[model samples]
Target: MTKERVLRFGRAQHLIGVAGLPAAPAPTGSVGIIVLNAGMVYRVGPFRLHVEITRRLNACGYPTLRFDLSTLGDSGASNESQSRAQQIRADVADAMSLLASHAGCTRFVLLGLCSGAQNAHIVAVDEPRVAGAIFLDGYAYRTLGFHLRHYLPRLHSAALWHRFISRKLQAAANQRGDDVFAVSFPPRDQVRRELTDMLDRGLRLHFIYSGGVTRYFNHPRQFRECFGRLASRPEISACQFEGTDHTYALQVDRQRLLQEVEGWLQRNFPTSDGSTA
Candidate 1:
């Protein structure tokens, strides 16, 4: 059995979230899992993915919290002036503190998708309490292989040529405003350095990509290509679901992702008694 409750936390109690707790005590070494908002979406995640993930982890004896960022969803805006990135990191830290006080969780694992994944990476790299992170459609850089795989197949399609010409024409027009929901990728070298630092500190990292970002990441091996020798680290694992959309819209795709997450947790953070808590 599992239990859940509403939580309001953060500096001014401006954050809102749901916490899923196991019926029995969590495993001796289980880490609390924090699920962040996907883009501008609420804590429920796209198609209630966050809710599903929280329940599944709860069943395995892990406490999970799914919450909105400072200005997104039900959370109130922050009064302090800070960059969006700073606000995100502060919000994540506040979440960890909340879980620590509420569930006695000293360690954490972050789970996110798309923009949420980027936030997870930012927080996990700097926060010492983060034991692991699961990133879906996270930071990806174009490689020689990516260019070949992306353009070669489309060369024969007349539609591609038409679209290319259309894009060129559109490029001459005035630029649009920045999209608040769109993710801004940091430098690849910076990300690679942070990833190396996290791995050196024994953090477990999982990178999963869907077909939605096929333009940037197509195959599983592309992870290796993007990060170079760092991809060879034993602490890192990755998967590519070729047909799955960015949000795992299909039921079957969602199920597959859930199963993968469960398996990774079991393999990396099993209970002391050799059973799921």
Candidate 2:
């Protein structure tokens, strides 16, 4: 059995959160999980993925917390004038402290999607308490293979050819102007360095990409390409759902996503006392 409860605690501000706990007391050293927001969608996650994940994890004897950031969902705004990155790190740290005080959990795993994934990565790099992290539809950089596969198929489509020509002419017309299509992603070298340091510290990382990000990540090998040899480290795992959308909107896709994550957690962070049967 699993029990759900609302939690409100923060330093210098109040944030809203929900905790899922097993009916029986968790064993000593049991790891808890924290799910971050995906953009502004609140802590419920896209399609309520966070809710399902927390409940399932609790049933398996691992406590879980899904919380809303300041001004998002049920959380109130903070008066601190900290940068977004600083505020996220502080909020996550506060969540970890709350779990430690309330549940006796010292170790934690962080999970997130999209922008939340970026924050998870940032925190995991600096926070030693994070034992594992799962990033869904997170950072991605284009590789040569992606470009080839992406444009090769479009070559056969007349509509694509017309659009391409129009875009080329538009680019020529705006050669001296700033690029309007530019998008922001973390620098590749910095991400690689941080991933390397995290892995060296024995951190477990799992990355899952969906078809929703095909424009940036089209194949399973792109992660390796972007991160270089670090992607092949045994502590790191990557998966690509070429058919599923970012949110796993389809019932079957969502189930598959859940199974993949649960299997990963069981393998990497097994129960210390074999209590999760």
Candidate 1 residue-wise lDDT, 1-277, digit = tens:
8789899899878899998877766644568899999988899999999999999988888888999999799999778898987898899899988877766677899999989999999898789999999998898899999999878977898998887678668755634765434676889999999999999999999999998787689888899999999999889999999988889999999999999998998888776666563
Error of 2 at 114 (Å): 0.3
Cα lDDT, model 1, residue 204: 95
Instruction: Report the C-alpha displacement of residue 133, candidate 1, in angstroms.
Output: 0.3
Q: Provide the global lDDT of candidate 1 against the true structure.
A: 0.87
Give the alpha-carbon lDDT of every model: 0.87, 0.84
* Worst lDDT 10-window in candidate 2: 177-186
TM-score of each: 0.90, 0.89
Off by over 4 Å in 2: 157-183, 275-277
RMSD of each: 2.9, 4.5
State candidate 1's TM-score: 0.90
lDDT of 2 at 218: 89
